[model samples]
Target: MKKYFYFLFFSLLPFGCKDTNGKKPIEITTNDSSSIYLNKAQNKNTKIADKLKYYKKSFTILKNQENDSITRSKLFELTKELYKNNFEREFLSSVNLLTKLATKSKDSFYLAQAYRSKGSFYKHQATKDSAFIYYTEAEKILKKIKHKEGLSLVLINKSLIQFDTGDYTGADRTLNNAYLISKKNNEIDNLYAISVMMGLTSLETKDFDKAIQYFNYGLEIVSKNNNIIGEFNKETCLNNIGLSYQRKAEQKKSVEDYKKSIEYFKSALKNKSIRTEDPELYNLLTDNLGYSYLKTENLDQALALFLESLKIREELNYPNQIVLSKVHLSEYYRQVNDTAKSKKYIFEALSLAKKEKAYRDYLNALKQASIIDVQNASTYSKEYIRLSDSIRNVEILSQEKFARIQLETDEIIKEKDILEDKNRSLLYTFIGVVFLLSMLFVVRAQRARTKELMFKQAQQRANEEIYNLLMAQQDVIDQSREIEKKKIARDLHDGILSRMFGARLNLDSINHLDDPESVKKRLEYLNELKEIEQDIREISHDLSREKQDLINNFVSITTNLFEEQTATHSAKLTYFMDSSIKWDLVKNNIKINVFRILQEGLQNINKYAKAKTISVNFRKENNELHISIEDDGIGFDVSKKSKGIGMQNMISRAIDCNGKLDINSSKENGTKITLNIPLE
Candidate 1:
């Protein structure tokens, strides 16, 4: 399985920080011992122990200082230096220091970068599980901030881990996602990394032509950088392309495809700059090209390349590459029919593969040994089968472990979303409850206010009724006093005074007359006295007599109200009262309330109905008093319940009179209010 590097693409986005300036962004004060030590520690020429001592001294001073932007930036500077120099333990400590400073400062960009750096360190240690965890954490932060370049690189690293676990499907999907994100931002470095990852996935799946296409695409982008990194990546692409063609050639048994593979491998080695810039790539190409030569029967060139690659690989002590080089050399000797030399190289390659745990290459070595050593061929073949099964089982277990990791990460994200949704729901519920409580409070307050207003209105109506009663009583008393005075004056003038006058005249003429005339005069005078006394008694009786009942009071009051309405409003009105009804027989309460209801109805007609003409009719029907007040005016809809106080007053008064009131009106038909009451 091939692993891809992605952290280099951090330069594409502002949020994706990288120390491309070769030093800290801030100036270091030379007055401080910490600054001087940090500067010396970052120097490439410093000894390893000296660098560690300086870094430790620098971090001691940094921990005492506040975690600010400048401090965190300096920590990042040191971390980048350690990471570049492959100082694993020092790099981890620097990453942790940066993380502490970034957390204290609440700097998400620096925190994510720290996480990515830590992941990169773990990847170097071949700790894929820890590397994937840190990369995922970094990705979570970068994605939220829309740091496309950084997220793309982290995703590529995760995909590479998937590739190592034989999760080609997961790797291809993640690689495509990384490719799209980088493509949107036009980030060339991230695109190249993802393209290479996709190419490796294709190569693993044996889609040789498709893998070559992806690697070729990566080569085009890397060729523009005229540096060691660009040259290294260029060789990687060319070597991977050659591998794809060589696999295709072996499958098809085509000499033509093999030549194509040789052409690409030779091109990768053509630039001598690559040999010195990236010695491992040069050595790898040399071995791979020699293997292709062995396939084509170019014995001289093949032998020379194989020997040179083996010497360099063994000197470097790279067991995996050394195993490959030795295996190729063994094959070369076998072709030349040097049986003893071939067995020697093949045995050494098998021993190294087992020690390095390079099982794929070990299987290859075992298969080669089984063919070369005929005496122990069965033993070699049996070992090959068992080792192949063990490797396959390991690959399956790795895939399961990585799949579980992916599932757990997805579950955490899902749980976070659910928690957010629940929080929102609780917020909305609280608001709804508060709103409902407020509405209830308002309704109670409104009800209290309405009840108070109604009580005051009832008191006012009671006072008005008392005042009307007093006025009517005063008018009756005034009319009685005037009648008494006129009657007294007429009795005195017509009878009492005239009789006294006759007595006085008689008394004066009887003075010279005899006793008989005197007696007659006295008698007459006495009679006159008796007549005056009788007249006084009659006058007293007349004064004590009850006043005449001239007309029904209910009719009089109703007529007076109707007259007042006509005079005040200056409108045509008609009022008819059935003379057959006994006003005296009706209870005063009924009369009073009916009168009030009629008064309210007429007032409503005057104030709102705007009727051209109105009629008030009172009739006795079925032992009930029927009163109808009609107004031919612009009317309101009868279907709608009226909220007007005037209408409510009329209805209430009618109910008080033990009557039913019906009001009908429409725009086309003017308003008519009818009241029916049991007269009994």
Candidate 2:
């Protein structure tokens, strides 16, 4: 394990690690060569407290080298150490190197290595989008290389990225892929990493059994290896196993595993003290210590460790880790009932998470805030439900958006194929048409010896020309009619509708005269004139509006006839319609059909038998027109009355618009006429 550090250090010696004059050196000793001197100098320097300093020096050197496979491999190792140590500056520097190196290398192995490094860096940074970018890039390269071990690493990296990105399903798939690859290659160390990632992925998804299985598998391998990497991974797996139980609501079992995991983390932290080269591991263990406390519900202890971890993170200027600390602190305060303080910290965390688009941290903060609100049960229930629904909606929308995008892509490909097929068909048709025309022209030339043939050709040409002209003219006429209808409809509604309203007002004033008989006669005449005026107004409006054109003046004429029928024919009239809508704008044909039908309806109701109670109603819906008129007179069975001309005419009008006409009547109840028409 320690020998691997030498390989990494040497790989990074060309960048900022300079000679005496502070200039980049052209040639430098490899990490293997430098190890001997480093060991000797360690005793001499005395203050060379950790391996981090050598790794940091190595990282600086690699940053100055032009992007290449060697630089990527070295920087990847360096960054991993930096991430583990919580050396943010060194970690960032190493990531920068890897990103640059990746762009310059066509070698899939190098690209995969660089991308894997980048994924790790962003994972620590808590930027899911950035991490996903790197992980996907690494996946592509690993796929190209067909290196099972390398592919496993890429998959594990991707799995962690997915977990952080709130793609639990994707994380599970990626972790499983890594596990399968590790098993296939018989790579125990690779399997160790894969298993740990798989365990964490399952834990996050609350699959306790799967998480336990993965963790136990990883723990066994780590026990067999008995190395620092293996030991650290094993502890992480244990911690994750505990989290799984907690998520499953098995709190007691969770606490037990958490305590054991903390012990392992403490042991790992001790590695920094003895190795002088393991600052990265020290920082990682410290962070994990805080996390373990949080998991165990030791809020105060968790807060203290998180604060301490943050101090190191801030010193390193790690933006992502600082955000994480705020989140943990927020959770601590929330758990302790410090609502205001929790809110402040959590909002700060939320702001940073949103700005960085860090899905993992954002979800964490959102969940904590939601829990805090739950204390005010009555007050916060609605808010809690709203927040919960919003989170679920966003997740569902994201999944749907991805699915929709894929579906659209598939559609586009299909459309392209269809277009290509159409183009080919068109080409063939054009060729056939041209060939037929050519043959006809040739035959015509031969037949030109006869005047009859010439005359027939002229007639055919003339007919074709006339047909084209008529089609063009029809289009022009339709457009002109539509425009005229709109203009006329608007003009008549604004003009005649106002006039009729004024006329009705004038007639109402005349009703105030003192002479009873004269006043009654004048009012009766005014009412008849009013009915006529209304009918004219409706007709004008229908001519202008297409909607009214279909209605056959049902709205205008029905109420008038019902009122007269009640007054003259001794029937009671009841009309119901929503006053909110402008009835005159109903389709003209519909209005006319309904008006005529209503006229027939009133005649039938009046002439049939001695009765009262005539009712007319007009209703408009989103996509259909409705008119109903009923009379409580001597009624007959509708099927028996189907032979009536009025009924047949009504039925024909309804069918013209592909509508439905229902005439429901019984001998004693009433005669009801119902017409429904689909509207454009």
TM-score of each: 0.57, 0.36
C-alpha lDDT values of all predictions: 0.77, 0.61
lDDT of 1 by residue, 1-680 (tens): 14222222322322243432223456646677767888898788999889888887887777777787767767776777677766777778778988887787778877888988888777667788888888888877776667776788788878877887788998898899888988998877677777777888898898988999998998887876443233467777888899889889888998888899999999988889866766777787888788788899898999999998888888778787788787888888899999999999999999999888888889889999988999999999999999888877977887787778778877887888799899999999999999999999999989977998989999999999999999999999998897566446534432354445545656666757778768876786788688678767777777311111112376876786688677556558998889888988987657656765666677667657878899999899899999999988998987785556556656766776788999888995788889999877
Quantify how close model 1 is to the true structure by its C-alpha RMSD in Å: 34.9
In terms of lDDT, which candidate is strongest? 1
Tell me how far the alpha carbon of residue 584 in candidate 2 is from the true structure, in angstroms, after superposition.
99
Judging by TM-score against the true structure, name the best candidate.
1
Badly placed stretches (over 4 Å) of model 1 are 1-36, 100-107, 224-230, 421-680
Candidate 2 CA-lDDT value: 0.61
Give the distance in Å from residue 198's predicted Cα in candidate 2 to where it truly belongs. 2.3
Clashes of each: 0, 35
- The positional error of residue 585 in candidate 1, measured at the CA in angstroms, is 99
